[model samples]
Target chain A: MPTVRINDENVTFNEGATVVDAVAQTTGRELTAEGKPADGGRLGVAVALAEEVVPRSRWAGVELSEGDQLEIVTAVQGG
Target chain B: MADMSLPPLQIGGYSLESRLIMGTGGITDLAALEAALVQSGTTLTTVAMRRYSPETKTSVFSMLERLGIDVLPNTAGCYTVRDTLLTAELAREALETDLIKVEVIADEHTLLPDVIETLEATEQLAERGFTPLVYTTDDPAAARRLESAGAAAVMPLGSPIGTGLGILNPHNIELICSRASVPVVLDAGIGTASEAAAAIELGCDAVLVASAVTRAQDPTAMAEGMRLAVEAGFHSARAGRIPKRQHALASSPMEGRIDLT
Candidate 1:
């Protein structure tokens, strides 16, 4: 098992895990290949890997690496 | 009487009927924020992007969605152009809107916008097809440059962020508004409803208030007051104020005082 940092938390996952798998494991919501929620609800989330934002369309192809720093952000109350 | 004299504040493809843009920063309770937001009569509101937490229960995005208010996501805490662009991209992805409030702060103490980086970010964001509403200082020249950089709107700060010191330089604000081709929105340092009105009276198309209403003792009351004040200011500006005179000019006719003579 390899560990990756997501939202400052270390998560262990098997090798060959895609970004979508990482997101699904962390958020508990499955995403379609198009990066939408499997249930057709609004996902309302975005992911940045190693300081570079990964587009939703590429989430399925981008595989996670060991010690990769991931940032998953959403809208919050602020100006 | 409600004043419906001015046209809607148009930016990019969006037309906002209300000129008051409420900010959600510093709000303690979501229910309270919703009440104030409804009372404010604002068609647009601001939200910021942060790391997602599963344990967090309150969803401000869902609340704004239910209230039918358009969310204007901001790059609030970004200090560099890179950070600003990244935050803005995230905002657009998560929120699914191209409207981004481009705020490139200088430092922590003052939290003033870094105009140099801000200008660069605005140009880049605009090039990326995002409607960048840039937040800059109350500098007329800077405002002009931002508008030239393809900003959808230029938000000039009244003083500093969350200081509540009110507009420190009305002359600069008026200058920015006078020459701006795009919409001019007074962004920060508003303490009360009067300041919100003052922004409009100074020729701003709209005003963005956060700490004033969200941190007030009674947020709902202040929100209502802000709504009324903005309306009053719009009408007063259009009504044409009388010129200032050095000497007293009595409204009563002097011809009626024959007995004193």
Candidate 2:
């Protein structure tokens, strides 16, 4: 099992799991490699792993490592 | 003059139809925020990035999409260059736009922009192919440095964020607007529609309002008022106001007043 910190919460994933896997599990929305919802809807989400922004195209290729810190963010009401 | 129209605001690669840029903050109700957005007639609106929560649905992005308003992602709560850059990167990815509002605050107490960090962030973001709209203090020198640092637009605060105190230093704002090569957007502390108008009158290219409209008692009405005010302000700015003097000038014919004597 690979343990990772996602949005400040610890979560253990199966071996060879990737960033998309974590996002799909946490958001409950199956996402494409482009990070769009598989249902052809706008996801409006972005991911940062270890404080480095991970582009949507590389979400699946970047495997989760032990103690990996991930941040998934979306739009909120702000100035 | 009756058929005159205000020119569109050109910032970076976008040509904004409205000079009043609305901020979608402090409005808890999504429906109300939508209404305000529509009523404001703003071609662009700003949104902040935060952690995603499944329980709390975010229709903000979808709503903006439906309304056809371009999103300007901001680094609102970031206090350092590292955090600001990360936030900006996330915003660029999430929003799929190169437009970023570089807001590096010094502290939470005053919510004033850290000019040094903001300058650094602007330089880096611009280098990364992002159109950085740097929010800064109403200091002419700082504004000039940010412009030189590759900011697409310079947004100088009239007062602290969320204060609604209005433009405290009109002279400084005027100076910044006059000297800047890029667009000058009056960012914070606009309390009413008049202040939005005042910004344009003071040579500001645009005005960004958040708390003034979002936290108003009647958000929709205030938004509409702001729309009208911005238009009026634009026209007034070009209309050329009368010069100030210690002595009052009579509007009526001075020669026709002899009958009263």
| True C-alpha contacts between chains kept, each model in order | 0.79, 0.81
lDDT of 2 at B34: 94
Q: What are the TM values for chain B, all candidates?
A: 0.96, 0.96
**RMSD, each candidate, Å?**
2.1, 1.6
**Candidate 1 residues B25-68, lDDT tens each?**
89879899999999999989999999888864228887888898
**lDDT per residue as tens, model 2, B190-253:** 9999999999999999999999999999999999999999888888999899889999887787
Q: Pull out the clashing pairs in model 1.
A: none
Q: Per-residue lDDT for B184 in model 2? A: 96
TM-score of chain B, candidate 1? 0.96
TM-score of 2: 0.96
Top lDDT prediction, candidate number: 2
Candidate 2 per-residue C-alpha lDDT over A22-49 given as tens digits, one digit per residue, 9 for 90 to 100: 8888888988866678998677889999
What DockQ does every candidate get? 0.68, 0.80
